[model samples]
Target: MRQTARPAHPHLLASPAFEELLGGGGGPATMSALRASERSWRLLVVRAVLDSAGSAPAGPLPPPADAWRLLARARTVAEEAVEELLAYPAVGVWAAHTLRRLRGTAEDEAPLWVHTGHLHAIAASAAVRAGLEFRTAVPVRRGWAVLPALGAMRVPEASEPSEWAVAEVVARADGVRVAGRGLAGPDWHPLTELRADGCTLLLDDSDPYRTLRTPAAAEPLDHAAEWQRLFGEAWEILCDTGTGVGSDTGTGTGSGTEEARALAAGLVSLVPRPRAERFRPHSASSGDAYGAALASVPDDGEQLASTLVHEFQHNKLSAFMHLFTLYADQGAARLYYAPWRDDPRPLGGLLQGVYAFFGVTGFWRRRGHHALGQFEFALWRSQTAYALRAIGGADGLTDLGERLVAELARRLEPLLDEPVGARARSAAELAAADHRATWRAHHLRPDPGAVRAHAEAWADGRPMPAAPSAFGLASDGSTIVPCAPARGFDTRAVLLRWLLADPAGFDGLRDDPGAVVSGARPEDVDLVTGRTAEALRAFRARVLGGDGDPETWVGLGLAARAEGDAAGEGLLARPHLAMAVHSELDGRADPLELGRALAVADGDSL
Candidate 1:
């Protein structure tokens, strides 16, 4: 007969911090559910690690026999962490400063780093209690390495040795023990430093990291010392909490590399962004509790620090979710419009996005006071507040989920009230607003009656009074339009999409059939492609009398303008034709601008 599995080790259950984390914000039933989840998680984590079998990333660590034993006995001090993920255990359910509903299913394969990071934490605490420094249960290999974390909150002096001994502490039910060589005096084995004051970028030649970022944009690092320095500086800035870099120093715990430092400081690992993810960051919906922080190189320390904190918060919540369900029914994965996103996300995705960004706002909150990055401050704070308001009490949350969300809102209250500048405020308002409009265009349908009424009113030459749209949206709150955008991220892309969606964009004005060019006017298209000023002016006159569409006229005018003119800029505020702007001058004049110029020059044609 098959044997039944025993409960998790008593050491873990005996820990108050663990009990409090799993049991907080819940009554007896909720706590009971959490306890069951905790036990499941413990078993699942161990089983998952074993399932990986002989993965390379885990190659150099202690033998599976020794490692598995220590892992089973490991104790966690995981009190719902926020803002920062000190080592692995202190990962907050959400950030300390970020408040919002979290959404997503508890159905992803937790990354290896999570189990390792958590175990690392337990081992670290054990060592400190024994009055000895701790090292990683992971050893250095060609592509993978983990170093000792900085002990305590004490800052190290410049001249002092920053390096520490490397160890891989394995655990058994009876006790925990350290395994690995190079445990003597200050050692540089875990990380190979490239530059002084550089965040030691541990060279991961391992297939997992290399393959994970194999895409051209996110291929493994160039292995330059300079690359290491840039990353190191980012860490140093985050460590400077005085500058508002969040509470963690981003140091201590495993090998002294920048990522390890962050992991030690309660962040997940730093994963390279694939080329496509250049503008934004991402985490698995299933939650990669191991903490994969995806980013490109850092040109701005503040932005980088904020990104680190933002993604870190996500990893924390991802882990938290592994222990409990934040929403009521996974089957009811209702999609909603989020203020800062382009596509519709499920309720779970919306919550996760907001939670991550709230922490990001906090990172900037601290820096904004000192750096005076008013715009960044304005944007993040306003956006976060809007998101919190939208999801704070919307629905689908369990009783436990409600309490946690309430606490998050309580923490967010102070952060949300801080002041912001006009430009930032405007952007904050615009982002959500744009998201709603775009969502309506994509997901909402105007009532047929309203549509017919609008048509008749327009034809009658007297428009109906402006009021809310009579859109037929679902009652599940999936159709809630975001309230926060004034503009879009890229007008060019927006215009392209608009043109594709609006049939009239190609058909031209009905009264002015000549408005849109059926085929590219030779001279106008030439003016844009050839950069000929003379051709542009002549081309403008050709389309001038024709009641050509706005796009046609804009193209002519764009080509006629003197060399070096800011193409399409005049259309920035044109609510009707706003989508045509391109990054590089589509050289030809925008027909709208060109047509207007002609109307001013000669009124007889009109």
Candidate 2:
């Protein structure tokens, strides 16, 4: 036991020291050992080459051929060491540490680390390729961590490891501030002084991407010192200003005035000088926490300032509309083409007509104007209606509603007119004619007597006599009246039966043309006509199935004196017209088999 201990293997001799350097680790220890072995082997190879090269020749006479051979062997050993070192565990730990440090830097600084690290590696590789022996024992000095926060030194370069140059550049800019030693570590740059109004430029020592505030909306800065000073001044002013509604009165006047002035100045600075006329603080709505514009009235000068710009657009548009329609009010010769002012129903009709026209013309298929119509309709039906209801009635406001409706119609009409094709005009005409015919037939043309009788019967809580049957003649032979046979019928069938059975009866009943129809009184007829006109329009389009001018039916029924209790006679005449049209369009009368199948499919007891 006292005898000299056997010498440790050459590999084991270095293992413990290498492990300690690598920090005790499974992969890292092994890697460090391999690197140690490679370095030792390379050293041995170099030693052997030198030994074989013999003593240096006096006066360096003739280059030794053996020196070249030894040099080649040394090069091979160096290459092998490099390959082994790349796979070393210590290298992996070093790389991981570097990456962690890079990521921990400010977001803007992180990119600099990446680029600089790449450049450093490239420089080292070039030096090694040039046969410059790198001292791996001496660690490369870590450059200043504060470079990125100072908004300087964007990229790493071999000659300039220090980021002082970048910091100096930003320090000289206006409205920027630099704190601490620019070459210091992470804590050197602080964002505590950053403020919206104070700083026109900011070094943004704080992590740009990590801020909870919206980065897109944030103003960017260029000079550190200038931005810092600006930010501080703005913040101080804002803090000193009064924001309360009554701050301008009495004891608060001084403070309030200063606050108002500061706020006004801040707002002015935000708007471009060219658009200053359009900028107004009072009209703009404040944004929500997420930076979206909201409809709520703003309490702060900043919010009000933004809102003014938006409201200005609306005011401008309203003025434009007023000017565009000035000609319409000039004289009696003025063409009163404003649909909404004349009739509420016309607005919808015009919109539908314009939309259909554009669709047929295939012009600007996705135009914003076309989509706006739907929005306008929804606004009228929902928001406008609710608003009107809240205001009780529009009794004193004679033309307000009408004017709004007309403006909407006018905006849509131009879109339709731009196409200028037969189909477009036809669609528009049909829409207008349909609206007018429906109004006239349902609200204006019914017999006064019939309307009065119906109302009286309703007042007395009694039903009017049953409507006459389709085939029945009046007791006086003066008229024929057709009643609805079923709750719903093929409109074509109903029309044909009525027309054939009562062709002459309606004409006979027209002697006292002004008289109201039986069962309905005069005033009652007028009210019913007005109330049900829109419904009648729909019924005419879908049931009667006529392509002819709807006015013809109105005139015929009124002029022929068929608008009394005998009004049923006029109703019957519609079916004949429908049938004739259908026959002409399809070249056949109702197909019995097809009708029967349809009835069965519809679950009808036909």
Candidate 3:
């Protein structure tokens, strides 16, 4: 086996490329750096396996040295094929997961060889692609030998699903065989690709490690044609017909084309996730898997287009992070709040949400001619802007992180002034305010002393106490605390979407909204559909009747604010404080009067 010398210098992103990534898109230079970073991780994993051969636990496969020799021989036959195999998304996932397990940094219960022996399967695939004659033992789980990007072979006669069995992979110039079964038979499953225009992607469904970072349940490929058709439609919306490639105009005929071009260049594989609730597309990406993403089928072409852009933005930032440190290591605390999520996020997670939504903002900005697009553009642009400011002012950011945040803010600030009609603007504001108020009420625990003082004073008919100086984000700071649903705020957001996209359909929901959406209430439908006066009465009634849902308080605040009431600002700004005081009164206080008192006591600083 022949070995090639590794590059002496570490991978780095040039200034221009880094700025391009910050501008909400990526290009060949950025993509190449990410791919190289993934390759480095793969090689690092292989080296770690070799070095730890002595202490690694026993399993069904050959020794680490023997497997390494087999992979080395394949590299000598076809260096490019071997590198490509190493850069495969699942390969990166396996490499990172295995390296963590091997170094004792991660607590994995599986035998060490179960992870290391994936090298043999990768080698076998490379040998087959190179047409090199070779034989090696690969792990078979659940009667299947998954060859990463190549495909999988069903070995029915192998060991039980709970245990790993070693299967012999013998390859020749003609074809490959697993356990004496030839590749020409039905037992061998080859991966398929979806092609449209100039964009091609591996529609990965069979890879064992294809689940990415989480253990996702796989669906049958019977609906493959439907997914392909939806993908083709999404491609039509995302295709770049402007400049040859990497050209994002941000306006007019070719706006978002550069982003589309970038998506095509960097996106290589997609794993189909189970269909999400409401048929909305769900997507996830990992820094370990640079070019790959997992997503459920989107409900429509517009959704598909945005979903792809969102996940690809995550991939771009992840890859960029792989090349450079963004923030110093954060201790174990998920303290920051992300507008898009209900739970408290860590600093790094907040940065990721900002970057991903930056891409989403760009997508809607380009499509702002329609009401749905305008509303989304208005909503996400504001949310993303706030998050950028939060992170920019945050401590622990490296010099590079500060620069990236500044560039992103510079690019996004202009969009804030872009007109999206008053109606769209109003709906966007309501939704954003609702989400913020609901998040605070759900996650931010009021200071107990302030709560008691305010409650006692209100009960005794004295002046209310001042707002709490600080609120605890979680009871336990070490891990992410699970949060209840966003009350009716999420339902209201959905109704707003329906109102913007399908008004007649939304009007039809006035009679019975719960018939359409399971948990949607009449007041929510009325609130989003412009019946503010009517909805205000209903929301006020709900709050006065001791309804403790945070959404009720937020809804009342939104309605009152729409009518320019000063008291509403207190509820919108400090719902956590209001809820604590309300609990002390046992829901007997008047909603507007309570809001007015809180606003007065807080000195209008709320």
Q: Estimated TM-score per prediction?
A: 0.49, 0.16, 0.90
Number of backbone clashes in candidate 2: 50
The better candidate by TM-score, 1 or 2, is 1
Arranged by TM-score, best first: 3, 1, 2
TM-score of 2: 0.16
lDDT of 2 by residue, 576-601 (tens): 22222333335232222111111111
TM-score: which candidate is best?
Answer: 3
Among all candidates shown, the one with the greatest lDDT = 3
In model 3, pairs of residues that clash are 247-258
RMSD, one per candidate, in order: 15.4, 32.7, 3.6
Q: Candidate 1, after superposition: displacement of residue 70 in Å?
A: 14
Please give the TM-score that candidate 3 achieves against the real structure. Answer: 0.90
Candidate 1 per-residue lDDT, tens place, 324-385, comes to: 57776655456654656755667677777766665566556655543235545655566666
Estimate, for each residue in 359-472, the C-alpha lDDT of model 3 and write its tens digit.
Answer: 788777767778888998899998888778778878888998898788788878888898889989988888887887777777666667777887888888898765442222
Ranking by lDDT: 3, 1, 2
What do the candidate models score in CA lDDT, each in turn? 0.39, 0.27, 0.73
Using lDDT as the yardstick, the better of models 1 and 3 is 3
